[model samples]
Structures are given as structure tokens and as C-alpha cells.
Target: MVRSNDNITSIENIQQAFRGVDYICSKQIATTLYLAFRLNKPILVEGPAGVGKTDLAKKTASFLNLPLIRLQCYEGLDESKSLYEWKYGKQLLYTQILKDKLNDIVREKNNLAESLEAIHQYDDIFFSPRFLEPRPLLSALQQRKGSVLLIDEIDKSDDEFEAFLLEILSDFQISIPEIGTIAAKSTPYVFLTSNNTRELSDALKRRCLHLFIPFPDAQLERDIINIRVPDLGDSLRFQLVSFIQQIRKLDIKKLPSISETIDWARVLLLLHADCLNMEIVRSTLNVFLKFEDDIAVVNDRLYELTQQATKEGHA
Candidate 1:
């Protein structure tokens, strides 16, 4: 049986539920989820990479105790890949096993025309749900108890694929020519995330509630670090977050994300480092930055970065 959001009756409850799962979110996120649930609409979450776009869906599933069905989008994604495909191997086996029955059904029909007509009657038999392979999109629709469907990185998919999602997003159903349209047994809570690689169609955007998540502020990042690494001393956490926030201000290919901050904190804990210093930061720079160029750029200003972080930590 599909569970309704009768339990999550208010925005405050949404915030509490997400907090219970250790996903610290702003009131905007809570309000977005609340409205999406109340309206039965999908949410389009747009933000830079690693701002917790994917984590939001995972945590929501945990909070609701529902199964999460994730479709990781990429270039050249299409309906057959995302929606459904015929189980050709199973269908072939079925056809072989049913050969005798087929012969018996056509025995009375002596003419070729009659035999062809008899086979046409059973054409749809092979195309039934039994022979259909459900992909993430179809699987979500088939769930009796509903699910949380996360379409991660929708922007990477081709324009054709984006258009293909229109019917499913607007109607909570998919049309299979062989089997006709399949509607959701229980509408899943849908979330589509984008890193803004490209602009999404206004048509697709129109069907969803838009939510933009930017980088966390210093205090919020500190709170997140505390939640993620509780054993870390407050002073170190402040310095690390402050350093990251400052680095974000510099022109870089990729800024350190909230997850990376937590990871750096864990690294410091393992090394038994109580504070951010030039030596420690230099060695652990790779923990946060992905590219060597980004590391070198930050390294050029390591002294200045360290001094500022230390000053902010003291203040």
C-alpha cells in the first residue's frame, strides 16, 4: 500500500524529518518539499555540483521510509534506456516453449490467411508486462507502495531525452506503443537534479517546482561540519570552514563542497591535527581539491590563506 504524506502535514514537520536524517537544509528546501508533496508535483533542484542536490533525495527517502529509485542521467540517454525495453531473451524462450500450443491453435486454420489471423490474436500476448523489462522510470510507476524517484544530473542528457521526459513528468505515466500507456499505481515523489550544464527546456521546467541550492554560509557550514564530524574541536571546524569559504571566493575550476569539508575534517581527526597550518593544509590539499592546477593555485597563496583562517578562528 502506498503511504501518503498525512504524517508530514506541515513545513516544520518536513524540516524536523530531514534533520532527523542529519540533512541540514534551509527553510527554502523544507518549503519546497512541503509544497511538492501537497501539490503532488516533482521538484527540479538546480545548483552547482556537490551542494547536496543528490543527498536531499536520499535523505528524503530515508525520512519517509520509502524505496529510492535513482536514474543517473548522462549524454545520449533515451526512452528505451530510461523507461522500458522488451525482454527479448525471455520472449524468445516463451515463443519456443509455446510452439506446440501455437501449432494446435492454427491446426484448424488450413489457409495461410487464417493462420496469420490466428497469430495476430496472440501478438499482444508476448508484449504483456511479463515480457517487459522495466527501467527506473517504469519501475517507479509500477511500485504499489510508491517510491522516491531521483533523476540525477538531468542536464547532461541530450535534448531529445529531455523532451522524452515531458510526458512522464507531466502525467506520472509512460506510453509504450506495444503495450499502450502505463500509469503509476502510486505516484512517486520525483526529484530531478541539475548542475546547470545546460539550460533545461521551459516545457520540462514548467512541470516541476524549481528549487535552487547555493553554497552554505559560514555558520551553516560549521553546523554541517559539527553534525558530520561531532568529535572535531570547534576551533578547527571553524578554521577549516572559514578557509574553504575563502577559497570559494578565488577563481577555481571546482570549489570545495560541504561533503569535502566534512572529509577534510575527518582527515584532520585521523592525523590528530588540532588546527589548520601551512604544513597540514599543504599535505591535505588533495582531499578537497580535485585538479592539480587548482591545488597549485591555492598553494601559491597558502601562507595568506593560513593567516586569514587563523585570524578568523581567533575572532
Candidate 2:
């Protein structure tokens, strides 16, 4: 773990820390994380699915030794779900428990006007933080030690929700009608990921530092496989990564991600396969491709892919 008082102040240090955790990242990613930490700005990490956008946040938290608070966004997500909501059941029980006290206070009141005034004095009691169930957004703010706040897949959320995030992202605070404003005790390192399901608003984009994480190049992919699946032989590792790289070049519904590459590597390790071959590749094609159509397409080209991998292995 990278200590808080250590060398994380530099981009090179950031890269070294991530590498310590076996997460091989490019210089651009290291720089983005460095700036996000130094400037205390939210990072808008846009990339294809399974390219390690979400993993970046998790690894940063582990490297920094901070808690990771994740809010998984989806269609129809709203402020109440992502932010805070009143604990209605708890509030109701409290209200029931306070009924006797309320009656006793009202008994001393002269008339309806006095009784109303008495009730108004305690109006804010129900809306306090005790009864406020803090969701991911609000919970991040309340962390005195700070945290890594990851809003995963923000593009899946509604436009209204995106607009709501603008204030929090910019100011590190949230506004509640009951409570005028709730500022962060300690500003958290924030990261928002998008799969590009829809275009985010310019206002939202303007407030964040943007980064695009594309698929890793062949060498980087191989390094990642080596680190993650160390039990595999060097020969098999090269052939497997090369095969996946070739698969990504095809026109498919979903390309195999870095995660899938690691998965395939592990599967091969478990099967005690030393190198890529037609029979083994055919049997494990499902490990790389997801859709049935993608499987059929790769099946048609499997022999050729294996031949190419074999030629590269001997070269």
C-alpha cells in the first residue's frame, strides 16, 4: 500500500504504486490520477466496458488505503436513491414514541395557535441526520477520513440525475431542503465511469477532468496476463494474448476485454494447457466470446487464428 505521507505526489510514484498491486496502467492513466488527487477534482473516465474503468477506482482506494464507496447507476436512477432519503420507518417509530411527549407539551398551550407554535419548534427534529439515511453520495461526504467515491456507469442514469450530480461534483457538497447545505468533512477522490450509452451534458462534462481508457496494446496486455496468471508458461501466455488481440480486430458485438483475457489465461492454466492448439482453442472459445453469434463467427475462423498463433510462437 502507498502510504499517505509517501511519494504519491508524482505521476511516476502513482504508476509505481499501481504496479505494486499488479494493475499495469499507462502514463496517461497515472497522470490523470495524479491530477485528480492534487486538484481534488472528479475524474470522468470514459471507456468501453471491461477496460478497467471501475477497477481503476478500486485499485486507487487500495493503493491509498481509503474506503471505496460505489454507486452503481442505471436507468431511472434518482437523487433519493443515489443521495439521501428519510428513514420513514425509523421516523414513524420515533413519531409514535414521541406521541406522549407531544400531548404533554400541547396540554400546556392556551389554544390552537399556541399548540401550532409548539409543534413548529420541533419541526426540524424529524429531518436531522439521525433520521436521514445517507446514500452513496451523502455517505461519501460524511466520511471524515475521506474516501474514493466511484459512480459507476453514469451514462445509464437519467438526465435529471446527471444534472443533480453537477452541484456535488463541482462543490463537494449537497443541498437538502430540510438541511440547507451539507458540506464534505473531507473532500473525497471522486471517479465517474461511462460506457457511452448516451451523451453526458456539457455542464456535467465541464466540471470533470476527462480520461478515455482504450484497450491495452498487445505488449501491455501480455504483461497484465503474466502478472495476473503467473502460473502460465511464457510460450502459452504469448500465444493466448496474441489470439485475443486478433479476436478484437474482428467485427463482433462485443470484443474480449482485458478482464476476459485474464479469465482465458486462468482457464488455460487450470486445464494444464502449455500452448494454443486447434482442439483446446475450440473447446475454450466460450471463455473468450460471449454471444452465440460471436461464438459461431469465431468458430469459423478458429483454425486460422490457431495457425497464426502457432506461426508467431515459432517465429
Candidate 3:
């Protein structure tokens, strides 16, 4: 644990705290999170695209009252972008200032060798902390009061970047060639999320506590919608969740995610829909089902879906 606020003594405490922050956490989620806190391990969260993988890290930071430092990963992501980069403009500015003082030091040197040696003394000044711009990885490590580091979409990044993160995740430190190795002031709680586009390296997985967030079931998703949109009538909320659940089982191109379900719930609430009638759901199909083909496929079965959802909702 990095600070006094790490008082997450048990799984229930994590659930309670997260619920207080408007996040509904499952037992599995709470347990893994509790273990991560106690063992000081980075969690590698993998799942389908919008199952709240990234939001878990955000909410943890919120409930723990820690600063959230995010690094959105992409293809070709490297250490300089994710860890640190030299403030080249600032360094160049200082180089101009150093040029002004150049004559003072070299003028005192008798010969070329002596002047070269004298100039070398100021070489390190530009590479020092004053000229270094810390990125998310370095910034998280430097947070003395602790922080949450979210590396979103790790699968989108290159394997080299994944390998590069191994050292920082395992040891809570990073090596900078210009500055040597810099250890963390207070270890940050780290969350690395992947949409599972590709298989991750074993080395990277070994260093982290793996967690998979699958699509929520009807009851869980209904609860999520209820909390997120409290003003939504209970019957309509259930109907919408039931509709989403039914569609998820269909052989569609993209199953509607929990977020899309929530979006649909809000849409229904705004439309003042009192029930899951075919007309309203038909018009709002685009809210959750993204692909045209997906929408068309669901549209073909809209009558049966709406009937089942309405029947199940009232049941």
C-alpha cells in the first residue's frame, strides 16, 4: 500500500467505497482489486471493447482519492512517449543561454583540449531534471502521495512497448539513460487495459494480476442502468436491459456493450418512453447497435425481441 487511504481492508470495503463513488462493482472485481492493493501489483484487464475496463481504473482512482494519470496506448508507442521525453524547446532555449555564457568559460582556457574539457562540464545541465518532461509512467512514479496509472488499450501498442513496461510494472521504477534509474517516490496503483485484439506476451502477463471483464448479464446491467439513470422508470429500465441482453445473444457483428446499453437507457428516458413498444425501440435501434448490418439483423426480429423483452420485463 502506498498511503493511509489504502485502508481497503477487505473485498467488501472495496465494493462499498466504489459504490459510494457511483460505480457498481461485482465480487470478482472487488476481490481482484483488493488483492492488487494488498500485493502492490499492476492489474492487466482484458476483455471486449466497452465492458468498463478503463472505467474501473478511473473509479478506483476516484474512490481512493488518488491522482489519475492516463496513457492512451497506440501502435508504435515507445518509451519516450509513454515514459519521458526531453523538453527539446526548453533545452534549446537553455542552449541559447549557454551560448551567451560560452565565451566566459572557454576564454579562460589556454588551449583547445582545456576549452573542450571546460565546455563538457556544462553538458550535463541540459539533460538534468530541469529539461526532462515526464510522461505518464514517470509522472505516476513521481507522485509522492501515490496515484493511479491507467494504460488504456495496451493491445493496440507494439510488443516492444509491452516488454518495456515490464520493468516499471514489476519494480515500480524506470531506467533513463540520461538520468540513470529513477525509482518511485510512492508506488502507483497501475491498471493496463486491453481490448484483446491480439495475444499479450507471457512476460507482460506474468508481471501483472490478470482480470477479464465480460459483458454484464441482464440483472447486472439493469442495476447499472438503474443507478446511472435513476429517474428512468423501473419497468422501462428492465425492458431496455432485457432487450439488450436478447440482442447480445444474436449473431450480430457487434454486440451492444454495457455503455451502449446505458446510452440507450438515457435515450429512452429522454424520449419519455413509458414502455418497450416496437415503434420506440425501432427508432432507437441505432443508439446501441452500431453497424448497419447489425441494426438490419435486429430489425428483422424487432417484433419478437420487443415482445419477449416486454413480457420478460413485466415478469
Candidate 4:
């Protein structure tokens, strides 16, 4: 079961809030979220992909008992897609119904346009609620229940999309030309994550508290592996994490992350292996190394490690 926001007080509590995460990351991410909640500011997180940047927002929402609203950013994203748009088909149907009620052809056409215009005036009704279709930001605003709105991969978006968010964050309000403005009953706790594929505008960064998440060091990686794969014996856990860390240090195109450490350990546990040996490491190498090129690279390195271990054992 998850704890509520009322139970959270300090940065450490957020460590417990997101279980199975590294202590350094847990603290940094939790502090970012805590500060956001305390000051009503958005928290912007920048990191490499698969580094738990997106997961931090999810844990925060779950811990706080808030609704999670996720906006996946991509190339070609625009205001209408991010905010809202009218369902023209429904509007056309409403216009046709009004046309049927009139006798004169000219009057019928004029009445249809007036009727369509009146639909916009109904503000409270008539409009097909197409503009009412809630994107992440708007959904968070409309939520009477509290929400955590996560704008993911903001760097993938164009500058125009970033510009649009500035007003929404400051006011917690969105303006619809047909329906006027809508404001939140309570502002959502906002978290924005980026893979840093592109540089974000300074204007956007200034609106939020910021955090940069890097990959974990060896000790933290071991701790994370232990938590994620608890059944592994202490000796094996240390050995495998250390070995993976050593392997990651070599000249490889891709390095295993804290997550990959956990995955490798879990794979070992499933195999019921009690120790790290040449056969076990080679058999389960897939967890730590993903691509065929990475595997080939590690396999050659593993042979070297095996020879070193054999030498040490003989001595």
C-alpha cells in the first residue's frame, strides 16, 4: 500500500515514498518534488533515457494520492493537440438539424449558421465537448481531485509548444476562443522530464525547480540491485554488481544503468544461481548487455575475466 501526502514531511520521507530506488536518486528526486509541492512550482528533471526520470513523477503521484496526467511530447506537437480542439463533425450535425426546421432555403442556411454560433454561446452546453477533450495539462486543471501532471520529453517538442506551456503553468488556466477561459480548482503538481536531446529554452526552465539525474555509482548500484533482487545472497549480489560495474567501465557503446543492474540480478535469481561464475555470467549476459554488438564485446571481455579469475583461484 502507498502512503499519503499528509504523511510526508521531509526529503527522507520521499526516499521511503519511492521504494526500490537508489538513495541518492530517491533524495534528489524526492527533494525536487517536495520543493515543488511546498512552493507550488513545477519541477523540471533532465537526464538520459532509462535513468528513472519519468518514474520519479509516477512515484510522486502515487505517493501523494494524486491523479497522474501524462503528456507524451513528440516532434510536430502543436497547441491544438496539447490543449484541445472542436469536433467539427458534431457541430455539423447540430447545424443540419437547425436547417431542417426552416422552410426558406436562404433562411435555412442563415439559421444553421446562427444555430452553430449559438452552440458556442451555450458555453455550459451545446458544444460537443470536443474542446473539452482533456490533454494532460487541461486534465490536471479540471481535476477536482488533486493531480500530478507529467510533461514527458519536453526537449522533443518545438519552441512554440514550450511557449504555450509558459502561460498555462503561471495561471493554471487555458483560454478557448469559443468557451472563454478555464481555471483549475487546484493547480496540479507539475513534473517535466527531458532526455536532453535538445536544449530547453531558459524561459521554460525559469518557471520550475530543476534537477539533473546522472547514473548511479557502484555502492548505490549495489544497493539498488539488492532491493530489486532481494533473494540474491549478499555475496552474489556484491559480486555481480561489481562485475557489471567493471564491465560498464570498459569501452562499450552502451553502459548498463541502475535498472539494468536490478534486471541482471532478477535474471540470476530466476535461474536459482547462488554465485557468479563463468558459466552463469555468460548464460545470463543478456540482462546486462542488450544489443548483439554489446554482447559480442562483453563476451570477449568475459573470457579475459575468466582467465584472470582462474589464475587467482590456482594461486
Candidate of highest TM-score: 3
Error of 3 at 182 (Å): 0.3
User: Least lDDT summed over 10 consecutive residues: which range in candidate 4?
Assistant: 100-109
The local distance difference test score of each candidate is 0.92, 0.90, 0.90, 0.75
RMSD of each: 1.4, 2.1, 1.2, 4.6
lDDT of 2 by residue, 207-291 (tens): 9999999999988998898888988999898898889889999999999999999999999999999989999999998987999
Q: Model 2, which residues run further than 4 Å from truth?
A: 1-6
Question: Against the true structure, what is each candidate's TM-score?
Answer: 0.96, 0.96, 0.97, 0.83
Rank list by lDDT: 1, 2, 3, 4
What digit string (tens of lDDT, one per residue) describes model 1 on residues 118-143?
A: 99999998989888889999999898
lDDT score at residue 245, model 4, on the 0-100 scale: 60
Candidate 3 lDDT (Cα, 0 to 1): 0.90
Worst 10 residues of 2 by lDDT: 1-10
Q: Which 10 consecutive positions of candidate 1 have the poorest summed lDDT?
A: 1-10
Model 4 lDDT tens row, 122-169:
445445455256666777788887788999999999999999999887
Q: Model 3, residue 119: what's the lDDT? A: 90
Model 4 CA lDDT for position 120: 45
The parts of candidate 4 lying over 4 Å away from their true place are 1-5, 20-25, 97-131, 303-315
> Between the candidate structures 2 and 3, which one is better when assessed by TM-score?
3
- Write the residue-wise lDDT of candidate 3 on 104-157 in tens digits: 989998999999999999889889998889999999999989999999999999
Q: How badly does each model clash, as a count of residue pairs?
A: 0, 0, 0, 0
